[model samples]
Target: MQPLDAMSVFEKVSVADIPARSARRSKTTPLREAISALLPEEAFYVPYFDQETGEGFKPSTVAQVVGRMSKDSADYRYSVRSEASKNGCYIICNPKPSNG
Candidate 1:
């Protein structure tokens, strides 16, 4: 048997030959607005990172937003679990029940 040619296995098509589709709108809500709407008993997941790392942890925006909000409020209570794949963590926010 002869050796297989890698390029010969696949067919190449021109970019212009591809079908055109309409642009889809983004479904993303503003971060602050979304965070502000969280129910007291609701738990949300956010990615986290370590500031001090000769290891391999980068800063996460979700983590920062949650942290800032927690610092700004006395009633905010949260639990975090290390879930997901490598270098990822989940911040589960469990805020205290409001008086009202």
Candidate 2:
């Protein structure tokens, strides 16, 4: 698969997509609340880990929120995969493709 441009993903994600509750909140809104409100259904939520140590990295906070939310909502979708690469581990979010 081709590499995804992280900035492109961020550019595409609109604040309008976030729920009204989150959008109306002050900047001091909690991280978990912001992330949970922003994420759309069926988004590809990938969480990275150290290939050697098998420990979560910086993006783990978002992963933890998504993991917890997944237990309650069937709309969330995510996967775990192991691959060898020179680059360090990192997580990402991408919009899922439509069937049509």
Candidate 3:
């Protein structure tokens, strides 16, 4: 008796025979997801923005990033921006900072 090759057996399998796994939508909102993804921990602040001056600043770790992001106004459009540095983060202001 001849043994069947694994590759040949695999090729014979029909796509319909395989069970499909359903992808469930995430319960967290996009805002939360982005925030969490950008700031995975709480060790340090991400320096998202200056609470008083409303200027963006860069922080090193994910925690710093999240901490900084947490200080931002939850309802503000600027909070949606996520980047590694202050230059990349969003700053809601008129006549944006000259250095930025």
Candidate 4:
């Protein structure tokens, strides 16, 4: 869905944002890792693109991968949302830093 207003904000996360597993750590999905590498918005929305790799991912594939994680995933302290744009479907990851 499209963002209802212009005030909505998001941040792209990175592999660095994700913590390493503990001796009893939880599992991480491929989707979760990818979402972490997205771009976060400061004043405005920035589209998803991997600068280090000089490549991008299909929004649809992103959405599906993240969706799977939501069903059976660890608490990564970030949330994923999909939005519609003139270009196509895009994904956003909102940071929710956790202390655990």
Model 3 lDDT per residue over 1-100, tens place = 5565633443568889988988766422333445544422222123444678765443333334334555563432223234555444432311212343
Q: Native-vs-model 1 lDDT?
A: 0.57
Which parts of model 3 are misplaced by more than 4 Å? Answer: 1-11, 24-100
lDDT of 1 by residue, 8-96 (tens): 57778999998998775432234445556666666544444446643323335555656777777677654445666745655455766
The parts of candidate 2 lying over 4 Å away from their true place are: 1-29, 39-59, 78-100
TM-score pick, better of 2 and 4: 4
TM-score of 2: 0.27
Tens-digit per-residue lDDT, 36-84, candidate 4: 5654441123244456865444655555566664445344323434344
Cα lDDT, model 3, residue 57: 43
* RMSD list, candidates in order: 14.9, 19.4, 14.1, 19.6
The lDDT for every candidate, in the order shown, is 0.57, 0.44, 0.41, 0.48
The most accurate candidate by TM-score is 1
Query: By TM-score, how accurate is candidate 3?
Result: 0.20
lDDT, model 2, position 91: 26
TM-scores, all models, native as reference? 0.39, 0.27, 0.20, 0.30
* Quality of model 3 by C-alpha lDDT: 0.41
- After the best TM-score superposition of candidate 1, give how far the Cα of residue 37 lies from its true spot, in angstroms: 1.2
**Which clashing pairs does model 4 show?**
11-40, 12-38, 12-39, 12-40, 13-36, 14-36
Clashes of each: 0, 0, 4, 6
Tell me the deviation in Å of residue 58 in model 2. 4.9
Error of 1 at 87 (Å): 8.9
List candidate 1 segments past 4 Å from native.
1-29, 45-59, 79-82, 85-91, 96-100
